[model samples]
Target: MGTTTEAENKPAESARRQKTRERLMDAAFEVFSEVGIHAATVEMITERADFTRGAFYSNFDTKEELFLALAERGYNERLELLRASVANIDVIMPTLLEQNPGSLTATELGPIVASFLEQQGDNRLWFLFQSELRLLAMRDPEVGKLFLQQKHAADQEFGNIIAAAFTAVGITPAIESVELAIVLMNTYEASLQEAIMAGGEKVQERAHELFMQRMLGLISQLAS
Candidate 1:
């Protein structure tokens, strides 16, 4: 009876622990998003999650650790979204086909990718979070090393998605898949940064569409 009770309690305990961790991470994401990693405090995260400082410490040793965890979570979430969206090629195909009839050129497909990229969430929040991480990585050696490792993993996953997307449409990627992925990603980021810096809400509203157009032109040149 004692053994059975202990066994039954173990799974329940584990689930509770997982729930707490997720709650903490979710709160941290909001706090970090609003105030940034440097400005965010454990207390703020705990208060947002309605947990205690002890709870935060139980799951994460340091603010930096939590920040890294948040970054990893973002990367994983994005990969999941990409895989799910890729699985349903129809989601992308309609737009690509409508853009320019006949066969799906790389140019047409590029905009479809831009559309999926926008589906992740609020562009301003994402851009701010990413910019913060990049700046922090550049300033700190240890963080920089960790960031590079994380970026490489993310790049590989994105490259796989790009390869799958091209293969699905029956067109081989014109360049090395990873290189092409890098180019597309860089273009998207740079365009977003420029839009955020220069324009108002109107720019934010149409930023994704503008990016798609720019990417279509660039990808067409690159792929051809």
Candidate 2:
């Protein structure tokens, strides 16, 4: 009876732990986005999360650890969004292909691509958090190693998505799919930084559209 009771309680304990970790991550994301990693404190994260410092410590060793967790969470979240968007496109693949026979041009599919990218979390706060991490990775060796690992994973996942999308449309990328994926991502990030520096959310929004325009031109040139 004792063993059975403990077994029954284990799932509930696991659920509680999962919820606590999620709350901490959400709070860390907000705090890091608002104040940045360098300035953020564990206390700030716990306070925002409505949990005790003990609760924070139970789940994470340090602010940097939580930030890394948030990065992984962000990556997973964006990938899910991308996957869902691609699934929707997949539903219309036959129609899309029929409409654009022969090699696909960016002009032909630019809106679809732009729409997919635009849906990828336009939160300014998240963007700020990402920008801060990128700078940290550039300057800090420890952080840079982790950041590069995360980037490589994201690039591979995103490259697979792009490869599937283009293959569905019967168009092969002029370059290797993963390389194309990295180039597109790097270009988008550069444009986003320019937008972030230029002004407010409005500029950032316009920047995505402008990025799509330029990306379309580039893809047109690259894709036959």
Candidate 3:
């Protein structure tokens, strides 16, 4: 009877634990969003979660570990959204172009790019991660090399998608095509960064339209 009772309670207990973990994660994200990765700490996180200090330590080994987990989660979520969006690129690309028609009006790409900044989200976290990893590699030169190799491979896969989208003509990308694609990506990032810093609401408009036109032109070129 005792064993059976314990077994029955296990699932319930497991669910409660999951709930607490999620609460901590939510609180941590809120804190991280408010300031940044470096500024957030265990006390800030636990206070936000309404949990005790012990709870924080119980769940996460250290602040760095927690930060990495949070960064990883954000990265994974963004990747999922991007992958899903990419899957529907055939549909999403054109619909946005059709919808917005005013001066510097935001199209679908605007919202998509905004989703990436994630409001309070740390864009710098990923950049810092890569930089730190590279720095560590310079010293240790062991695990870091393999880790970077894997990451670079994954990055290349995403790059191929951009290249293919810009030159999906089944034809090899010409020097002009590659140059245009690189330029378009750089332009989009620059404009988005400016939009973010400027507090301007709809900065993706011009770059987006310009890029789309460029893509269409490439497509036409491939067809011709």
Cα deviation at 52, candidate 1, in Å, is 1.7
Worst 10 residues of 3 by lDDT: 101-110
**lDDT tens digits, residues 1-224, model 1?**
34568878999999999999999988888888789898999899999999999999999999889888888888888878877877776666765645544467776677566766677777666777878889889999998998888788777777777777767655677788778778878878877888777868865566776687688678765564
lDDT of 2 by residue, 1-224 (tens): 34568879999999999999999998889889889999999989899999999999899888888888888789889878877766777554556677776556656665555555667765566678898889888888988998898888778777777767777666777787778778877777777767777886596676777687688677775454
Judge candidate 3 at residue 7 and give its lDDT: 79
TM-scores of the models, in the order given: 0.84, 0.84, 0.57
The Cα local distance difference test for each model comes to 0.79, 0.77, 0.53
Question: Which residue pairs clash within candidate 2?
Answer: none
The backbone clash count of each candidate, in order, is 0, 0, 0
All models, RMSD in angstroms: 3.0, 2.9, 7.3
Q: Which stretches of candidate 1 lie over 4 Å from their true place?
A: 1-4, 94-102, 198-204
Instruction: Indicate the worst ten consecutive residues by lDDT in candidate 1.
Output: 94-103
